[model samples]
Target chain A: MNVAANEKEVKIDTAYPYRTLSYFVEDPPTGNRVDRFLEAFAVVLQYTDYKSLLDSYCTTNNKCNRCAVSCPVYQVTGNPRDIPCYRTNLLLEVYKRYFSIGGWFKSRLSSGIELTEELIDEMAEVFYRCTACRKCSMECPMGVDHGLVTRLGRYILSLIGISSKALKVSVREQLEGETHNTSKVPKVALLNTLDFLSEELNDMFGVKLDFPVDKSNREYVFFCAVSDYLMEPDTLMGNAIVLYAAGDWDKWTIGTQNYDGINYGLFYSDWHLERIIQQLVQEVTRLKGRNILIGECGHASRSAHDFVPMFGGKEAYPVVSFIEYTLNCLQNGKIKLNPDIVTERVTYHDPCNMARSGWIVEQPRTILKSFVRDFVDMEPKGRANYCCGGGGGLVSIDEIHDFRMEIAGKIKAEQIAATGAEIVIAPCANCKKQLKELVEYYDLPCKVMGLHDLILTAIEIPNGKSAVERKEEAEMFAM
Target chain B: MDAWIEFAKGPLFAVSFLIMILGLGRHLFLQLDGLVRRKGRRLLKAPWRKIFTDSLSWVIPVRHIVDVHRTVLFSVSSYIFHIGVIVVPLFLADHIILWERLLGFHLPKIGTLLADVLTVITIACLLTLLGCRLFVERQRGVSRVSDYVLLVAVLIPFLSGFLASQPQLNPISWRAMFLIHLLSAELLFVLIPFTKLAHIVLFFFDRISQVHWQLRPGAGDMVSETLYGKEAKV
Candidate 1:
């Protein structure tokens, strides 16, 4: 709850661009287009199962406003509109105006407020203000999910093609484009990256390691956030090393057709959510794998773990998070790590998506306790953890770089600064990137990394070779 | 005035009470109908039992007690206010007599002094809550006209009943205060289903979706048991 003193800090209150989210939207909603807005609302009413959800959120006066205390955005900005309840009401007000029985009477009898493009425009701006971390749902006595309402708002807006262009274009390439992934990495590139990682890892450890690819009927099918292939080689390498320790090439394989696991759809649109999940299931079914092992991306893991059933139905495989799989291996004594290494003052950031439901929170913490010498926890960590201000796909947009650091992530920055950690091990790829920016932006004296990145550094090799020895040997060879 | 009071309590009260019950029932049924329609459509079944049990476990609002320095006072006020709203109306000597007359059943009534004390405390709590909304900038900003209306509407009956019970304290005529009390209570009963007050019954369904809906398949009993200790407790 303590923020570090900054001479150049942007005040969240009474500041224009700091409080305001600036996005280059593809079709910026213009005028009071009630007809188009109503059309989309009607479609949402028919398709989405949010009628019951919006009912409680719209109807309830559970207005204790305690969620403001829980919301990092509201806390930093001191803006009433930034409150989670207020944000949810932005959508619920629309729902009440058009859909509800009370709204039916009120529209004719009372103020006669109808859905307008102006409200939708406000929804577009405000919905993104939240990281959609969902720490707020914990405080609402009515348990109205503010995050779900945000998603529902985004979903309806997406129907009108009014979502973030960053999310839109990436999703475009993922679903319909030639290379069906958000990063648009070609098959050759994915394979080459893995091949190069295998070579790099093998040369360091003096052990032959080939990344299993395109193998049929394997026990585990790996689907990582494609960005991990390029940006986080160590996370992929750690997972590969851990999985190999658990079994071998016979046990796991990455599919050639669609190995990318990122589904930004989880953040915004149900159309994309279902489509991406169906595609992920197809890739798994193509390989006939026994289980789905998702790599170090929180939303990616959540989409597979939770939405697979919602979207895939019969094609749903047992989705295991990379952390969970690695934890299982550690628990089973399949893998070992040297405990004395990674001596820095370390802390973990709970990816709001994974930590919200108590899914991946304790697993990573438990894994960290095994190796980390002085691992500290944020004051209100796990389930109640503040987001890195990069959730809900806010990290992907370069335009909001300062916003993500100065205001959106201010609370998280303070949480880290309070712990005085030299290293922050955020397991999610998005979290790591945002926290890295946060460390740089705020000048927090720390380094940001993935949990598996540490595991890669500390993991004991099978052939009696320690990673320390390998690092020394590589350093000696370089000399 | 006496006749109007009886009229408000008898036929009018019956009609309004029935509307509240039926309207709220319809809302619950529709919500459940939506959930039911989408239930089997998805692959993994939500841990309904655990979710509901955990939700019921949190009914006392002890979670906020952890932040005692900050939100505890407000949460306690809300907790007591809700209790008083339900308990005072049900167990007050006059109301129990009315219930006995209507239902032909034996009922217990609280002492008038105790009931008065609770009514005062509850009124203060409700005022504290409303004052927070009205005075607090952030709370006022998030609030709608309907929110303010709902709180004042709820307050009128309690205020009128307390004043009527003590004729010395009544600024308005005793019969007039009594009439206002009966009519206001009737108005609340009629409006309950149409407004956010419907959350009285619907909180569970709202809670279930947000709390345990994201639970991975087969992790329900485990997580619930670990978090709340055993799944089947009410």
Candidate 2:
């Protein structure tokens, strides 16, 4: 169906208003799809054996609404089915009908529904609807990790060849293909983009900056969301300026093999997540870098910092977020910032992966406070901040644009509007893209920028050569 | 009727109490066993100190339910109800006298007026919670048959006990009302392990398992330490 048609069908403030059998239906699989799905489900159960835990919350009359009250999607759509507990209950129903001991008794006692394609389709549709933000789990008195359950559901769906086209194309095909990045920018194009960004930096800042690529034996191997190289040149330039000013130019090099740090696998499929992490580990190892520095993307930073050890095992090197690295540089007085560079009121949006996952919360705030003179905070910022409505790879899929803007993004738009900040410093790439779109769609009269972008504006590069001299040197190098 | 009353107060109560203990014990043991098995596969070193501190924080209603979620009215009412449910049953003069007669144990008892007041508040809170489940759209969406049934199960005992204490308000015979109250209480005890009341024990375990359960420092840092054996740093 067309986007507009889908939007028109979705009625707000109703129970399962978007429920249509068409959205759940998929083409028949080639060979014995039911057996394959059940087999995959069995495999997943092996990995996640929390049947008792599920039972604790799944009991009849256990209407623990802690998760429901906190769920952002349910908060927006007002759909009971969208509640995190309800979603988890759907899985629990599946477990009870198929696997649990009590399920055996239930099947015999009642005319129980069989696990069919329709059930799988509904599960896929609902599971993908969630952002897997874990915000619900945070407030849940039972601590039922619905996020993990949703992820497992996605994994099982993928096994049955039921998955989102956007996730498959961007995360699986593109990353596994020759480009090795989600944006599909080839190596040549990447180098050319860097060169073009370098020229732009020279024209704008009148400083000679270099983005080292493929240089070996560096202290830090910088990996950023490849989209940043194309969409947010200023963010890339900001990263370069900070590294160069910190006198870590020789210590850091962007890997030629895997430049993008984004792991869409975290949002959709575990196989994709594992492959992405393995590729990152291989890239860092190939360069023999001391530390893996993930640039301003929340999920990528989190995946690299947390999942790498699980996937990389003994080969896993230390993974640090670019924000943490920058904060460390500032703390050690490795770089200086001109406080008057930005005078506008600035606020920060905590990416769910960073804030909720507890990866790099304070570092960004510390950096933001250093340069932003008129700094303000979004109410319930830090750990309690609302998602940008484009998390969980939702930003990549154009099909859900209206759903994001109207329902999911509603609370976030209000939060940003209430802040009344001139600029919003969203460090995560996904959040930046979402917030930027939100500003345009909501007409909120605020510009969205990366955290490093603000730092770049405020950073005072150490004086070494005059602007004219640097331009002449650049010209000489071009010759 | 006399034989049934004797059975209800003797063998039936003993049987229900046994079921409650064994059923809840098995449930808790299985849960902890799952944790142990999961730890082996995940290679997780338990952060006992942080777990204990986080569990304690949640145990205090002010820190978790009130301060964290800010559902002031619901949380406040829940606290009062829980206090009444626990305090009145153990310390009421009638229950203390019964315990003395049956088990040869005696404890200090609260004044009948105070017990009466506590029971009234407890019953009121139970009704308010039931109303919330029935009327609140979000709560109603998640509510199941068992939820309403469980609430009714709990309410019967409190209501009957309250009526029996206030003879002026009693609509039934004192002996009949008292017998009904004891039977309902025994039914609740038997159902505790099989129903949502398991949360009374599961709450501590669940709170400790959450990602937010960090007391030493930032939750993220603690997660990093647990996952990677070192703090997340450059």
Candidate 3:
């Protein structure tokens, strides 16, 4: 584990173009001892053990570039180092130097290369550059899960305190703060936001809508991204209106503490992901809810619906997307939409978590079609859709906003422009944020809206009062 | 010359075959061992079913090749080269004769003309692939010395065999051409298990692992409970 002691003899291979020192800036030592970092790397490798697949990926004759060709980031950047396989190799090279059979032989032949701090910095930079969208995994011939590799790389980097400040702060807030939300919206603030949303909905639709909080024994424990409380109240109002119209008003309630479904842990650290999901499961179980209905956030829904069970074991309740719930309501004739209300040319952006992981691709489209007069599909819609460049917590990192806009977000901007749609329906919260930024930065003639936003505009909410009462009120008004 | 040919066809061939078998067996065994060790409390419901379907899907070029625009040409050329290499070597009269002589079993053979045409096509495809690796900017960035060496190793046998089969087109004496062909083929057999060529057998292992890892049941619920303690009651 004396990795740093042997660092003096480490020879940087200048022959390799990417190994140049110019691409990286050396940071002062931050108490991350080389021995401890090596231990963490070994532990992660043993936990995942992707050696055979990685070996084949690097050595196979085809050197399959399917992941690279399909990767939206790489497609936009055109940097060979950004290729998913190449990025994975950065970790593989470390594994080969210290732990592999070849490394054992090579160590005997020469003082082998040490995993340097600079190399770790480069790994951190490249791994974070990726969105962890898993679109690359879908196309890889060997099924080398690049998403897993990226997350693991980030996890290892996190051990040495090499993660983004933005993501770290969010996780800290959720775990340590009393509010238990990433945005740190307090309980009273959340209730006030809900009350404001109810007022807004009544003003617009002439119907009373209430957002139930902390009620027990509901059929579903609804969770939305915490940012919705302040940034997107319309979306929250849309959720309430749809739920009330669908006759599920009494069937669902939002938890007071664990209402926010945004899980930034899925972006970097496995430790954080597990803790967040456990808290989510505990909230649902405590409420005596029969099901967990995750609202219109891609990674949140994915974390809750897909990874929660994996981390928490089988839950008493089933986890579902609010999109699926709406689709069911539409199918059952409990709710109806007036298509003329949304006459603009609309297109859908498939959040990678929903389309690729959750298989919630068609459900959003179904909901959109039910309300929109003109619905267009992106050229490569569904699972193959390009990332909004803000996934993997990149949207939260303000320092890299330009990097996202000029590079990672480029392909998505182009994809949206190609469709020539005026309205882009991003069902996931993360996608909406990225898409909105892309529209602003690229100056595209399109506006970003949430699926629930569209639903609020077109949904037909029935007046709860009886017809006789309404007629008597009208007669009284005439008198 | 006769002595060299005799050794090439006898001891050299046997030694190479033995190394290839043991090497491939060890490689596949280690991969399977890794798979078993990594299974850890995770349910692989219908693993065999997943492995079979995934293997079948990957073997066909349609999904992996034709559907992806960037890989269509490379995948098509690879498919053609792989078919020619496997089919020509196994079904040619000369190879079947050797197999029958060694193992006392013979299979039906393709016509000599067809075998020759396929061998030529395979060599051409291999050369094209080599060119792509050398010339394609992105591919060149990832290409290593082993990649070039492996391609040359595969190409020598096919090129020499083609020349040996048609003595009229031979660039040297018949005995020399035949020896070069035999020696190169033997070299490939020895190298297959140690080099990237191991992918031939390891492809199944990689694909199966990928499919099973993706399909691992309860992936949604199997928290790294060790990392996070028991769920706290709200």
Candidate 4:
């Protein structure tokens, strides 16, 4: 599946800095300071942590400005002040004016002009425009994390009531609802999805398997996003087949009630985050599950791997990413996959949530290599991987699509072109959706396949089932 | 005359050297105090391997020197300036006379004509570089007023050396070159503390900032807990 056109360098628009700047200027921090002792400390420590970051990473006025020029957001807006360099300078000015000797001398000279509410408002605007993707961190002579810096700045902004509406709503829902703003999904919808997946699997491969949803007391529990079930049913079906191929059909059950693994709590408030994850852990424990496997979602994986250990409070149980667990099963002969199932030339996109935040880089590659023969690697991969433009809730704001596609996907489009691989194996839900938009906009010929979909396609079934049989099984169960 | 040049040169070099050391020492002391008070442990404890191995790391032990790209013009200019600075003082016949008086030994002159030609070219390049820096838009944007002043400070030494080295310009070569070159270099030494050129002192602050954070026990979990609490179900 060779692409007809090469989208090697998609140009990002550098307009709209004023709008971004204005938004930051006007918007007050949205969520309340979470009650958790650690969170309060984390929120309070944001000021010192940010200063430490600057002191450690950006002390040089000369060397640390690489982020100002090369940043995608800055490139899009053409505003130096909104970028990390000047944003940092804003903080440094605060440090000096309020804290340093030069600041004291200048104050004495100027009759003591203190940092006011107006200053905080302007600085907040400058700070939040950054998505904190850490792309500029790659170019800095000092490996400074502007992403963490921006996040801390945004957190501080939240304390002052100046956060984005989309982010705020998402945070509110996660905090109160213990779900990522997704409505309470109908059990029938999930059951229908499982039935559909079962029929698809039967049609594609001559294997009859049950993908049970919300079954109590299962030995193994699998969690997936509700969005995957609705929009990307194949992602769900793919996971079903992988589980089946791994010979865990009898042991595993998919949760029917609000199976979304995405924790919006991670984005805004830490309090709701703990509540959400603890509930998930409780569900697993109540079911008496031996192992819990998370589906192909980036933020979800971050919740499981990063947030779970910290906030989950106890050594709950064994929790693993679907990719890792499936790969292990395949290696140990628990699951057998045919090479012909995934014959296309494919490349992997490392999700920011999994790659940068979770550090789950190698497992997906190992899984892909076992199934994909012509597996190619994109340059600037691993921890240095670019965002899919959808991770930080940017894709939800439909108005920013044009800029987001051009700016965020610009580098990703180049990485895809460099590979020349026919299929892109992005194991993330948001990354998959964004790539779909990119492939359409840029006219790239490659088909975007979720990691689960490819796994389902290649997994060796018990009977001699064709691809149609598996699809039938999936559809049948889904219905 | 030899004894007089020797006596003047020794005091001039000593004064200039002492000023540079004192300026650097005070700058470092302040930075250390700030580091301690601010708790810049990551930068303080940064390992050498982490400094060199990072993709974005450019190791400059000194701070005030500016970037390699931005400083290319100045560096190239300084090459010529430095040649004049060192050779004019060390290789010139008058300089040798002062050295002979001070150390009681006179080394052979390789080629006085070639030496004179090199000094002239070095001084000319140095002047040209300084002129361009003042005029160029990209250079001027980042340049402070003191940057031009430093360039002139550097240029005076070369200009005086060139004038002193020529046969026709030689009547007052010893005193004029010695006085102008020594005074200009000394003036730069004084101005360094007040100028952006003090990055020499600031470079250590920048390098100290370059120290990478090695993930400590509980640090990763602590960050996660703070960002996303344990019970977050989304």
- Models 1 onward score TM values of 0.91, 0.86, 0.87, 0.66
For model 2 chain B, the run of ten residues with the poorest summed lDDT: B211-220
lDDT of 3 by residue, B102-149 (tens): 779988899999998999999888888888788877778877777888
Which stretches of candidate 2 lie above 4 Å from their native place?
A1-36, A111-116, A204-206, A464-479, B41-57, B60-72, B89-114, B211-234
lDDT tens readout by residue for model 4, A48-90:
3334434433234432344554465655455545456566555
Docking class of 4: incorrect
The fraction of correct interface contacts reproduced by each prediction comes to 0.38, 0.26, 0.23, 0.05
- Candidate 4 chain A lDDT trough over 10 residues, lowest sum: A29-38
DockQ of each: 0.24, 0.23, 0.32, 0.09
TM-score, candidate number 4 = 0.66
Best by TM-score: 1
Give per-residue CA lDDT, model 2, range A1-479, as digits (tens): 01112223543323343344222223434566667776766665455444445555444325567677667788767778788887777777777778777677879998876776666656766786787788777666556778777876776676566666676777754455788888888899989998898887776566777778898899999999889988888788888888888898899998888898988877766656766888898998999898999888999988787777667767788988888888889999998877766778998999998887645678888888886788888876776677888887778877777667777777788888888889998988999988888788777879999988877666777664433444456568789
RMSD of each: 6.9, 6.9, 7.8, 8.6
A139-227 per-residue lDDT for model 1 (tens digits): 77777778887887776676665778888889888888889899999999988998899887887666778888899999899988899
Number of backbone-clashing residue pairs for each candidate, in the order shown: 0, 2, 9, 77
In candidate 3, how many Å is residue A212 off?
A: 2.0
Which is better, 2 or 4, measured by TM-score? 2
Q: What is the Cα root-mean-square deviation between model 3 and the actual structure?
A: 7.8
Ranking by DockQ: 3, 1, 2, 4
Model 3 - which docking category?
acceptable
lDDT of 4 at A463: 65
Off by over 4 Å in 1: A1-21, A27-32, A471-479, B38-44, B47-50, B67-69, B167-173, B211-234
**lDDT score, candidate 4, position A465:** 73
